[model samples]
Target chain A: MNFALTSFRKDLSRWRQDLMQTAIWFAIPLTVGGLITMLMSGDGAQPHGVLLIADQDESFLSVLIAGAYSAGDIGELISVEKTTVEEGTERVNAGEASGLLIIPAGFGDAFLDAEPVTLTLKTNPAQTILPGIITDVTEIVLDAGFYAHQLFGEEINTIQSLVDESNDAAVAAIAVAIQNKIEVVAPQLFPPVINVEIVGPPATDVQVSLALLYLPGIIMMAVMFSSNGLASDFWVERDHGTLRRLVYSPGQLGSFVIGKALAAAVVIAIIGGLTLVLGFLYHGVSWAKFPSSLVWVALSGVALFSWFAALQMLFSNQNTASVISSMLLFPLLMAGGSFFPLAVLPGWIAAIGRLSPNGFVVDKLTSEITEVGAWIIDVNSWLIVAAAAASGLSICAWRLRSGFAQA
Target chain B: MLKVDELTKNYGDLVAVDQISFEAGKGTVFGLLGPNGAGKSTAINCISGLLRPTSGHASVAGHDVVSDGKAARQNLGVVPQELALYEDLPAIENLRYWGKAYGLRGAELDSRVSEVLDTIGLVDRAKDLPKEFSGGMKRRLNFGCGIVHKPPVILLDEPTVGVDPQSRARLFDMVEAARDAGACVLYTTHYMEEAERLCDSLAIIDNGKLIAKGTVNELRAKLSARDVLQLNGTFPLDETRQAVDTLIERDDLDLEVITQEEECVTLTLSRASQHLPDIFAVISNAGGVVTETILRSPNLETLFLLLTGKELRE
Candidate 1:
């Protein structure tokens, strides 16, 4: 039993016995990732509500107004149901429907005859978004009808007077007249006389699900969590007096630390593997790159753990070590894209994240182990992970031997 | 098997272990007896190569603790004051881990672990985690973990601090067994009975300094086989001291005042039981009323109290 191997087995057994803590370490970030995923998955998150139409007029124009609610994108949000005025009022009063639009009798005739026609829209005060949507859509439909009458009032009036189903000549003439009128307004609507530029965050044409957007960051979050936990075990050994016992042993403390870290690497790698598998199943992480991703995550985790272990060793108090490491943990998580992906972060923050250790892993994991459709292979990622792990563990090993156990 | 020569450890201005020197041969228990914070652990740590002595040197089986730390530690096993057994690790796993840490392996490690478990009387509960064990059981497992590899020198640092009576007896047996196996045991404790029972030699320490060192009988002989006489009654503190002083001066008595208080007076004198009438008369003549009295034979604790002018319990 070499000291390192012995420590590896001991730590692995300790972790097995502390299954609840291990699960908590794995579950916290999974829960966080799940929550963020839910938020992102519900991206349009539109409120659903029915819009009741009491079309007492029953005219073609009145029918057209009611049809607007059930057409296209608006139709997905607000369902349109035809009903009597009394029924519409009852539904709106009960808050079952978002709003009621009442088209009074002769309203269509009043509009065509150039007389004032009032359209009443009553909305449920209980809901905000659905009621607001219904009100906005009703106003747009009314405005469009008003404008059409103003622009082609003569043509519409003449067509109404010609009421003969066999009158193809009149129908053709009215259609031609309406076409000419639309052409007159075509320049204003097509290009818009005044150009309004709407600037926004650069759009990614790729329809990245929220889970995919956050998986890399969340994976790093899990690694950080695992690292912090593993780092604290150094204190556990110290507090339990095993460290002092080790000081009396022939085995080198450095080898012991490395062995324990190797065990932590296995635990973290399992976490990474399970999360990566999750990505493959639902978040579109490329299954082909899973093996390499697992290795990279393990390396990144040990590297981070080594640093935390070193930092924890510097402090005289275990609570101080825990508090300081935790303080450092959250910032790293935030800047490294654990809270949000670098692709979605602000330019400056994302820049910092891209240069950060976790951020580097997240970014590299994304570019190299993307969805099957956008996957690319870069072999050099292993070097970065390995180099970081080597440097960090080297520092940790030196720190442990220098005075930690002896102290 | 274990030797410490003028080993001193300093925490900046504080001398934690000040020039403490002692040696324990194979098959013998060398006790470091001191109350809490008396540098017992520090001296053991220095010898065990756990702490670097600021001055002087110590060796385990001829290996210098500082220069040949690994070799020195290779011959050492430490049972710290706190239960060092991992709470999550089962008793057997704890034994095997420490056994392996001492460089034991394969069949040797397994055989030794079982032997140590049997010696500690925990073989039946080998797979049980220490956290689930009774206080005594955990203490036994703690001891088991230390001697699993059977190092030549064993350092037990107050292993019986919080142990129950049953566990204390079990631990005594284990220490004796290790000593009988020809290992030099460095046992540090504050309990006088344990020192008298287990240690072949004792080093009485106080405030990081070795006040006295010798075999238990030799140290007690230093007390002149005196009996400590304690009288419980109303006695003027100054008069009581003066009376004892006058009596010692007049009779040329082998008596020394250990303590003098208003309600009690304590003196260590030769044949205190025989001199009880004289002592009572002296106290009465000094305006003191003796209501009750106690006589204790000379022991290591009496010697410690006499040498340090401070109670061993302190």
Candidate 2:
């Protein structure tokens, strides 16, 4: 055990000296994860696009439709500008806005009379997500209008006639009629009044951001990169002839293998810790679970590194082993939700992905982030990770004893 | 003391080492001399506990290699033919790691490492990595790693194969110092001169078999009655054979062909000086031209040729 620790220390010192390799390994996952998170996070999280609304109707209903997009949370995503038809078309064609919304002159009358009318939404071809969001929001507003006409057709018709006559006394009479009707029906409209009171201390629940949802996958990717770096060390040591010399010492070969694995675990932990801190600061990952999640991910990384180390023993050359391991790495990343979120995958694919070694760890991490107190008490997940680590280390030890690293 | 008793190692059907046995007491240097593929490494591997012997036993300082591997290995130091020091680590750091591997620790480890750095003559460059050192400096550090723990039984396997003359002389001095410090040294090399100069007793191996074993003078005495005559030049095979046949037909000249190549021929003569005139006439009559002629006295090289019927490097 002392010899193993000594070997571990030396290996770590060597890893520290290789600053360029360490920097490259750490950068790949951080850069990839950051770029992916920035691209996939939708307009719900931030301001998105410019929208030009050409309101030609000049009616109360037209103003109401336009007001739906100009206020509240939705307004933050789209900056709405009222413009003439010619101007709106020019702005959209000039790429000054993501989309143009035009309401025709007869739209209000058609909507009030329950007649079919087309509300034109011209989206820029160059923009994908922002323009698509504009189209979806317009469809939702049209649907709400249809429901409004169905429930209050008579009241809407009274307001329309007052507008047509352009008379103040007629609008006053219509308002009095609506007030009398509401006075009689108010008592029966809601027989039982249900009041909802928020009882808890102002809930600090943070809605999981899209980037946070993908944060676990990115963490797994970082672990994978660390594992690859660790696995390549076997070949490096062998090619340098140090491994064979070590065998001649009083230290057992098993101790050497364990020492190498432990050194890799340390590097993995460093990377996991840094990435989790980034996730907490930028993606709103729960700070309370950061320490435990980092530990879990680092253990998972050790298990993965052990498995790759065993695979490396089967290969004789560094370049061939690295190429094959990278080939395996990408597929594992894709299927394990490192490249794409498992939540977005089809049912069968996600099920398979969840069973992958990396996917299993990713699922546990994401659960710990989202569910309170789950990470602390998840014994089964920890046991699975331990079992994987044991199996991989056992294989590596057996191979080392069998002279797998010999030239 | 180091003892190897009938050590045999086999790889599938190929027997690499065949029942080799030898012993070296403290303060003595034992040499295992053989060409490439002569089971020298296999023998060393078995003795060092890296390989298990098929039908014999090896012990280091009375500790059995297979049954008490850790204790046996603790007392043994091996300098392999390959440069096995870490290139990324400084000389002092590499020595420290190997010293710890040999069970040295604390102040003793530090002191021993410093001593090895001084002994290898790299104390000034102890902080430099092996990659930054010259070939000679790296070889010295490679040797230093082996003796960092001051093991009693040291195995130096072809330690001076590719070193410069100065480094080779330095290694020789270190080996002498180790022997003077009461260490048993087992050195393997194919260089006959090295064996003659440094080894107190030597064993010559070929094709997994030990062909000869004794003190250098005792081994050389095997060829004291004969001399070696080497001729170098272009010679047709038929003409050389005819010349050799004619030379043997003469009653006064007793010669035996040691080796024949396209450009050179070597032969053992009972008395080279008295038979040289007739031997030259036979070669000249058979259309064989000799550009260079070398007459050698009894030595390890001649004994090696006499026993194996081939050159040591063949």
Each prediction's TM-score versus the true structure: 0.84, 0.85
lDDT of 2 by residue, A368-396 (tens): 77666435537888898988988898898
lDDT of 1 at B5: 91
TM-scores for chain A over all candidates: 0.84, 0.73
Indicate which candidate wins on lDDT: 2
For each candidate, the alpha-carbon lDDT, in order, equals: 0.85, 0.86
Model 1 chain A weakest 10-residue run by lDDT: A368-377
Clashing pairs for predicted structure model 2, backbone only: none
Worst 10 residues of 2 chain B by lDDT: B246-255
After aligning candidate 2 to the native by TM-score, how far in Å is the CA of A258 from where it should be? 2.7
Query: Per-residue lDDT tens digits of candidate 2, residues B239-312?
Result: 88888977777666567788877788888877898888888888878778989998988788788877887778
